[model samples]
Structure formats: C-alpha cells, structure tokens
Target: MSPQQKALILPEKQGNFKVGSRSIPSPGIGQLLVKVHSAALNPVDYKIQDDGIFVTHYPAVLGVDIAGIVEELGEGVENFRKGDKVLAHGNPSIIDQGAFQQYSLTVATSTAKIPSSQSFDSAATVPQGLDTAIAGLYGKHLGAGIAPPWAKTASDLEPKYPIVILGGSSSVGSYTIQLARLSGFYPIITTASPNNEDLVKDYGATHFFDRHLSGRQLMAAISEVTDSPIRIVYDAISLPETQSVGWGLLAQNGILVLTLPPSVKEDEGKGRKAVSTIGSPHVPYDEEIFRSSWAMIEKWLSEGTIQPNNYEILPNGLEGIIGGLERMRMEQVSGTKLVAHPQETK
Candidate 1:
C-alpha cells in the first residue's frame, strides 16, 4: 500500500485549491476509513473556499457528500465491515477537510449502507439534500401519510393542508417536493424560474410560481392553486427578497422553514412560525429517525418512486478540487453538483 495518497488541498483563502498528497487516513473509534470512490460538491464548498464559512483551518480538503468502499472499520464499529459500499455527509463539522481525499474518515453514525442496486454516483448525491429534507420533515405534524418513523408517509392527521417550498429548482427544494408529495400533502407549491417549472413539476410540485413574475401575480398564482391555507412552507432559498415574498404567501399558522436564516422575522399579516435549518447532523435519536428515512428513500430510488436529479461530474479525480472551487467562487455553477472521482480505490 502507498504510504501517501492524493488529496485536493485548499491551501489558502479564496478560490485556490490544488491536488496534493497526504498520508492515508486510518479509522478512529466509531469511524470508518473509506477509500473514496466519488464525491459530490455543494454550493457551500465554494462559499467556504472564497467567502469562507465554517472553515476551521487552511490547506484543507473539501467535500461533504461521499461514497466509498469501506477499507477498514474503526474500533467498536459493527454495522459496517470492510468492503461495504456506503455514502454519507462525512464530517459536517469542518469545511475543506472532508471527503476530497483519496481516503476519508466518516463517523459510523452519519454513514448509511448503500443499497446493492445503487451506483456510487447515485449514492453520492443523497446526503447533501437528503439531510435537509429529512431534518425539515421530521417531527412535523402533517396531514400527510404517517410513515413509520424516519419514513415519509401519507399522514391521516389532515389531508387538506397545503405545504409550500420556495426555490423548488434547487437540490434541496426538489427533494422536499418529492418527500412532501410522498407524505400525502394535498398541494405542494413552489417558486422557481420559468425554465425549471417542468423539472420542478416532475418532482411532484403540483403548482409552480415564477419568482421572476410580479409579486402580486406570484401571490395570486399560489392562492389560485388551492383553497386550503398553506400550513407549512420550507424555503430552500432564504434570501431577503424571497422571504419577503414568502411572508405574503404564507397562511395563518403556517410554518416557515429556511435553508438559511431569514434576514427579517416580522409577522407578515398572518400568525406564522419561522425557523431555519443549517443541516446539522441529527441528534442520536433523530439520526436514527433519518437513517430509517434514507433507508426508505433508498428503496424508493430503486423502485423508481423517487429520482436522482442533476449531477455535474468532475473527472480529474482529487486534482479537480481547485478548479471546482474556482467555478463555485465565480458563481458559475447553478442547479448542479461538482464531484470528483478518486483515481484508484483499495
């Protein structure tokens, strides 16, 4: 085995990264050492690379969504043994020092075994949006189907309530639409550019509003979709402008969920609940809940009930990280994932 392995290194601040070599990681307690097969990128990567956020150190490797073969399991880890294919949002705690290496370390708790029929690329796409969807839907009293814990099922609680998701064209937004539809929400409404209306609708968005349209027109469009008041809304894009528009569209007692913090929180003519989800890996119990949810999601993907959206593959292996971050910094990427393949896996 080689003593050193290749990794994508973000050596300093702002949009500069290069492929570098580092010692292969060994699994620690409750951690699994994975020979990275492929990794998927998120907008957060470039955000940290250029206009940094949650970065603890420099000269780091950046990637959160990972799919790999388990080379070795750390002490006390039992559910996954060597050679199991798995995917996870490995190490959300730090920026840049994640799965963009030949070998990566993952907590067993955050990792889920991949279904046999799933490809590495397919699995790699799960974590980034799945965590948001799973976390957002958990613990909510929805009229949708009652899924066995972690599962998104049609709830008998209330069939008539409506759920709104802003920015349905985004990766997280698309996932929320699919999961919400599965949960039996009567009307799933979302806002996106006109180009994405068909794509978003394919994901089960029963109604689509063009944010580019007039605010009054957008509101009237949403109001025209369903007579029942909007009860829950998850804003995958939480820009101030979107929130302002969202405020007007929300129904009384409707819960507003944001992917990022809303700039303002005034009650907009209706009693509403506002909250933000930073995609924190769930607490132990909640973790188990999502684990089960993803398990069901995995089944759905295989059974064709759910679909995998766009994936932008970067095939330069770990060496591609720098360029990928550069693209992100320039805001050249939209509605896609930037991913790299590990040259070789043991």
Candidate 2:
C-alpha cells in the first residue's frame, strides 16, 4: 500500500468536500488500521455536511459506516488480525472522526466481523441503522433472543409490549422488522408512504398503514391487525407528522421509542411510557451503547438473520462524497444507500 492515502475532505462548514491525500497512520493501542473497502452514507451525513457542528479539525472526513479488512492491529488487540474482514461505525465523538477515507482507525468494541455472504458495501450499511434498531426495538432486553449488545440476561420478557415501527421503509425500520420477527413479537405493524407498502410487507410487517392516509383510516387499519394494545414503538424518522400520528396509534400502556424526539406526554394511561430510545454512554458524546449493538449485530449478520437493503455504489472514491451528499440532501436518494469505495493505493 502507498504511504499516503486519499480521503474526502470537508474544508469548512457549508463547504464542498474535496479529495486530498494524507499519511495513513499506524494503529494505536486498542485500535485497528482498516483498509476501508466502502463507506455508507446516511441522512446524518448530509445534516453534518450542512451544519458542520462536529468538525473539530479542518479538512475532516464525514462518513459514519465502514466496511473493510483489518490491515494492522494495535498492541494488545487479540480479537482481529491483519487481513481479517470487518465492519464498523466510526464513532463521531472520538477524535478519530469519520470513515470517508482509505484507512480509518477505530476501537475494537465498535467493530464486528463481517459475514462472508455480505459485500463490503452492504456490510457498511448495516452497523449504524441496525444498531439503532437493536436499541429501539429490544432496548435493554436485546439478549432475550433478539438480544442487543447490552443484554445481561436472556430470560427477560418483552417490555412495554406490542411495539410498532414507524417509517418501516427506512434502513433502520428494515432491521427493526427483522429483529422483531426474531424476538417472537406477534403482529408487527409499520407505517410508510403508500408506495412502500409492498416493501414493508416483504420485511415481515404483519400490517402496513400509509403515513399519508387519514388518522381514522390508519387507526382502523392498525386495529384490524392486532387484538392486543400497542405498547412499544420505534419511530425512525421522528418528524412532527410521523410522531404525532404514531403516538395516537399507540395503545393504552404503550411505550414509544423514537430516534428523534417524542411528541406525546411522558406517561400514557395504565402505566404506559414514552421515551427516546437513546443509546447508552449518553454523557458528553460517549457511544458505549453503540459498541454493544455492533457486537450483537455481528453474530446476527453471520447467522443470516438480517439483510442490508438497496444500495448504489459511487465510484471515484472519496472524490465522490460531495455528489453523493448532494443527492441525499435533495432527497433524491431514497430506499437506496449511497456508498463510496476507497481501495488501498497499490
């Protein structure tokens, strides 16, 4: 590999990212130097690009999801080795920054072994959204069959039962559907634009309601699917319209899990609850909760339980980051992930 590698660089806030080369750093303690094969773009990527609130250093990288092979392991790192395939979400809180680079360094706990059946692009797409799903759907009880990384016991029963996933057509919603199915939840219901009803159905949604449909009609559709009340709910896109509709759909004694902020009262009737299902290590930008999700998803991906959704590969490596971000900003990229590839300089 070449001593210098190219990465997408955001020179400043509201700036267009350009391609530039930098020296690839060697592994540090408990870190791995990965030769990134691909980096998946998320809605947050465009948000960060627009605001640049998290850019501590100039010419910073801005991708979050990464898939690659471990090029070198830092001292005392035993779980991986040179050339071992892996996938990880580069935690933004750490000084390490992002993955829109050829070589990225990340903590071992934040990565997982990628399944052989999945491509680097697909593997890159799974970690962040899947982690969100694990957090939103299973929460603390992820170990009980659909156990997320934080589960300490496998005997825990479903909490705030009868969870519903709002925006089931999203990447996070896809995983929530799969995990809910694996967790033995009956009658998983979801809301999407009417066009995506068939796609949501393919993801194992027992019932599909259109977000554009009237509130009365949506409620009637949901009611026909389940005899029990809806308890736990995860809203991927926590916009006011989605949450307002989702909250009204929640049954008595229900708990709402929102990726964004909630619009309902803190407590519902009959011991019901509503809270944003945020990951742990919440203080001052710690992502310890994400670490747990990464590990648990590794096992699930390997077992073929979860699958990555539609994606479009972007060529020209990090140079293409701007174009990809532009497409997402305009909401042109829908139901498909924009992934940038960064190969080793041979």
Candidate 2: what lDDT? 0.73
Give the C-alpha miss distance for residue 187 in model 1, angstroms. 1.0
The per-model lDDT (C-alpha) reads 0.72, 0.73
lDDT of 2 by residue, 169-247 (tens): 8888888888787776778888888888888888788888876776678778777777677766777778777777677
Tell me how far the alpha carbon of residue 276 in candidate 1 is from the true structure, in angstroms, after superposition.
Answer: 1.4
Clashing pairs in 1: 61-96, 143-158, 144-154, 144-155, 145-153, 145-154, 145-155, 146-154, 146-155
Cα RMSD, model 1 = 3.6
The regions of model 1 sitting more than 4 angstroms off are: 12-15, 92-97, 139-156, 267-269, 282-288, 294-297, 329-331, 344-346
Candidate 1's residue-wise lDDT over 1-346, tens digit each?
6878887777776657777788887777888888888888777777777676666677677778889888888899988889999887765334322888878888777787777778788788778786777677663432111343334344534455678888897888888888887777768888888888898999999888876866577777877877777667787888887777776677776667777766757554556767666554633335555556655655676776666667777856776666776787676766566777876422
Count backbone overlaps in model 2. Answer: 5
Each prediction's RMSD over C-alphas, in Å, is: 3.6, 3.5
